[model samples]
Target: MRILTVVGARPQFVKAAAISRAVTAHDQSKGDLEDVIVHTGQHYDESMSRSFFDGLGIPEPRHNLGIGSTTHGRQTGLMMNALEDIIDLESPDVVVVHGDTNSTLAGALVATKRNLPLVHVEAGLRSFDRTMPEEVNRVLTDHVSDLLCCPSSTAVDNLEAEGIVDGVHLVGDVMYDVLLDDLATLDSMASPVDSLAVDPPYVVATIHRASTTDDPKRFDDIVHALTQVATTIAPVVWPVHPRTSDLVGGLTVPDSLHLIDPVSYHEMLLLVRGARTVVTDSGGLQKEAYWLETPCVTVRDTTEWTETIDAGWNSLTGTDPDRIFEAVDNSSAPETHPPLYGDGHSAGRIVELVRSLPH
Candidate 1:
């Protein structure tokens, strides 16, 4: 059996690492499971893209579309065109995609149109907002996919609500498996951010969502809130996104808030592990915080990971200063996290399932 996996963004790369390892580890009697990786240049920056592959020990992609930044339509279109060529050339038994990036949708559309089996990992996630491109990508991919590998029971419930029951399996989250395997190495590595002169017990904040950064008032409000959060919380360590840094250059920042360029994956994991609380609009960070048993105050109005909020470890503060302060002040991890996501074997389960398919 042969699997062609498409990945673009940073989160997708992290998720793919686990599954890639699983495929390499497990043996099949029918034949060797052949895995091919394609990288769409959605995240073009080295810090955001290549560094992750190097740090996580992910093999370099076989095919690189080089579809860098552009309008959503253009980027997806370019990926489809390039991926279609790869599909025709490789003609793999199954095309696998992870998460809700433009690459996921493009891979799904091309595979389904070509009549190849499409397997979607981390499927059935919904923020219920049409405005979010990710929400649209995930929803569309799930409908067309031949196999839907879900992360949690909540995700399964969401797919059932959408009337999609067949070909769906609760395979848990691949990211959790990566975290479990890499946590020891991540902790042992000295954080690159330590040289920036920020100490532990500081609030780690990352603001890079389009909803917040694109709007002037919303961005200002977030900056103001962080300033206020710092007055009470002391030091706020923010690993500013590249886009956010452009906007922040024009604004005056308080000394209490330390703004630095984005850190590597292991550096980030170290920072979040030692932080007093994490403030971010990133979906991945919210889950990572939950896994690390750290309190999180999300700056977004809605989150797809509602289980974290329900468990009382995460608070939705949006961009309001008062709410951000209140939530951060009251943040605390649950007494016991009962092992959400999986027991770090989700990747093996996914590979076994894919192997059983009559591809």
Candidate 2:
């Protein structure tokens, strides 16, 4: 069986790593699986894109549709057009996509239009906020996917509530699968924070969502909150995103808050694993913090991964200074993190399910 896998962003690369390893093992044992990778150049920077491929040992993309940064509509349109051509050329048995980026939407649309089966990993996630582009992408992608590989029971419930019962499977999270497999390698990687001369017992903070960065006032407030948390609770190590850096130019950054360039995937895992508290707006980070048994203070009002909140591992603060400080000040991981996601075998299950489908 031949499968065309689509990924564009940093997070998708992490998700792809687990499944790629599974594909390799399947090919060696079964000798019938052939998978091709297609990279949409949504995240073009080496730190965000190429480094992840190198760090995770993901095979080089067979086709790179270089659709770099642009307006959402234009980017999606270009990806759909480019993918349509690739789909016709390769004509794989199935097209598999990950997460809720513009690339995911484009791949789903093209695959469905071409009458090819679509498999959406990380499906059935919902923030229930239509204003967020990711929420829209997730909802639409789930509706059209021929197989929905969900990470949690909560995600499966979300899909069932939407009346999407067909083709849904609780395959657990591919990210957790990678985390378990890569923890030793990540531990061996040198911590960037160690060289920065920052003290330990620090909080790791990251803010890069459009909802916060695109709005100057919101960005300012989040920065102010981090500053307070750094001074009052603990020092903060922030790996600033390029988008956030552009807006934060000329703004006063507190000494307690150490701003550093983004690190590789392994570096980030080490930093978060050792952090006293994690404050971020990134969806993946919330789960990472939870998995690492670190308390997380989310800087957003809503999160698609509500399981963390229910599990008492995550707290929402919504960019408010007082709330952010309070959440971080009282942050603590749950006594028992009842095994969420899966047991590091989700990728094998996903590949098996896709292989079972009729060509």
Top model number, lDDT? 2
Please provide, for model 1 over 1-359, each residue's C-alpha lDDT reduced to its tens digit, 9 standing for 90 to 100. 78999998888888889888898787444358888999988776765677788888979889888999888999999999999999888879999999998999999999989998899999988889889988999999999988899999999999999999999999888999998899889857987557767776788988877778899988888888888878777588888787687898876777878888887777888888988899999999999999988899999888888889888888898888889888888777778786778788999999988887777
Give the per-residue lDDT digits (tens) of candidate 2, residues 152-266: 9999999999999999999899999989999889757888888878767899988888888888778888888888988787889999886677766676777888888877888
Clashing pairs in 2: none
Per-residue error at 173 for model 2, in Å?
A: 0.4
Off by over 4 Å in 2: none
Number of colliding residue pairs in model 1: 0
lDDT of every predicted structure (CA atoms): 0.87, 0.90
